[model samples]
Target: MLKNKLATLLIYLVAVLITVTFICILADIIIHGFSQISWGYLTESPSDAGRAGGIAPIIVSTALIVFLAIIIAAPLGLATAILLTEFAQQKTIFAGFVERCLDVLASVPSIVFGLFGNAFFSLYLGLGFSILSGGLTLACMVLPILIRTAVEGLRATPDDYRFSAAALGITRTTALVHLLLPTAMPAIVAGLILGIGRAMAETAALIFTSGYVDRMPDSVFDSGRSLSIHIYDLSMNVAGGDSKAHAAALVLIVMLLIINAISMGLAKHWQKNRIISNEIII
Candidate 1:
């Protein structure tokens, strides 16, 4: 009984410490961020000296990159997950190898992805330093995460559903489309949110592939910088003190929070619906 109590106490202590650390970080960000946030500051664009301009362009560019990256990553990631979970049998050696390879790919660093993007998309593929190239690179960077999450979501669905659909003489494609995908919606949505967040926070990869253009992205072929890259440029290379960088960081944090909140709400709604459906079936 004493040992069990000690172990429980240790777990609670660790949990509290982690919570405290996270709260401290959040407090720091909020304190610093609120100081730099103002109507005039957020609305205007930066001037040549990184002063007098609002962060409008940076916000716009980041949105463009994230939106385009999600558009590209979602279908590919979802399809890959569906294929792996629904079609690929675990008994096959090739399936096992592919799954292991995906796990390895997920562990790769973001900078390496940036380097690969710079070489293949920018130079070899001749896409040049454009938003499309950058988005593609980010898509690849987040693909493994999205795919794995989606696979887990798909796999988490009860096996009985698949068996029932199959027993009803449903085609494999039809069963996946109508049954499995709907059941895995929450997981897929969660993965998409994560992918979007990753795309938003990426800096090194975007720096090399996207270039440091500060204008609005008129097309996918146009060059632009994400919020992360913008913050890096302002903090590192700009002549001013770190004021603009701090403001940009604050904005990025706020945007990420909003996205996360929305994603969480949606996931909860989906989960609730799933529970209701399951109860009804029972």
Candidate 2:
């Protein structure tokens, strides 16, 4: 009993420490950076190599790149998750192999992915330095995360649900579309938020695939600069760029928090609606 109590205390202490550290960091950034933000800063193009211009183009590019990546990855990841959880037997060799590949892939460093994107998407695919190349590279990086999380969510569905559907003569396709997918939506959204956060924060990968052109891109095929790359350039390359960098970082953090909030809100609404529908049917 005493050992168990000590272990619980230790875990609580560690959790508190992590929370406090995050709060401190976030507070510091906001305090130092919030003052630098202004409407003009958000709407105008940068001058003096990011020392004087707003991040309008960078924000637009970031949105397009992350949106493109999710659009490409989400369907592929969902289908793969359904295959693993619904069709393939848990003990099968193919499932095991695929899981192993995902595990290895999730461990790969971002820089390596950047290099691969440059070599394949930029050069081989003739995409050149463009938002499309960056988006595709991020999709590859995000796939493992989306698939694994979705698989877990699907597997967590009570076996009774499946049995009930079978007894009701519901087709597997209908069941997956109407039941399983909705039930697992929360986990899928969580994975998506994480993937978007990573994609938004990425610097090296965008540098190679998207290029550093700060001008507003005419199309996905045009070279663009993401906010992350702009932050990096301002901080490391441009003199007197610290204030702008901090403001950019603060914007990045705020954007992530908003995405997380919106995703959770939608998930909760979905689950609540599902519950209401079931209660009515009964």
lDDT of each: 0.84, 0.90
lDDT at position 133, candidate 2: 99
In candidate 1 the C-alpha lDDT for residue 230 amounts to 79
Q: Flag clash pairs in model 1.
A: 44-54, 45-53, 45-54
Per-candidate RMSD, Å:
2.5, 3.0
Candidate 1 per-residue C-alpha lDDT over 184-219 given as tens digits, one digit per residue, 9 for 90 to 100: 888888988989998898998888898898876788
* Top TM-score model: 1
TM-score of decoy 1:
0.90
State how far residue 229 of model 2 sits from its true place (Å).
1.0
Q: TM-score of each candidate?
A: 0.90, 0.88
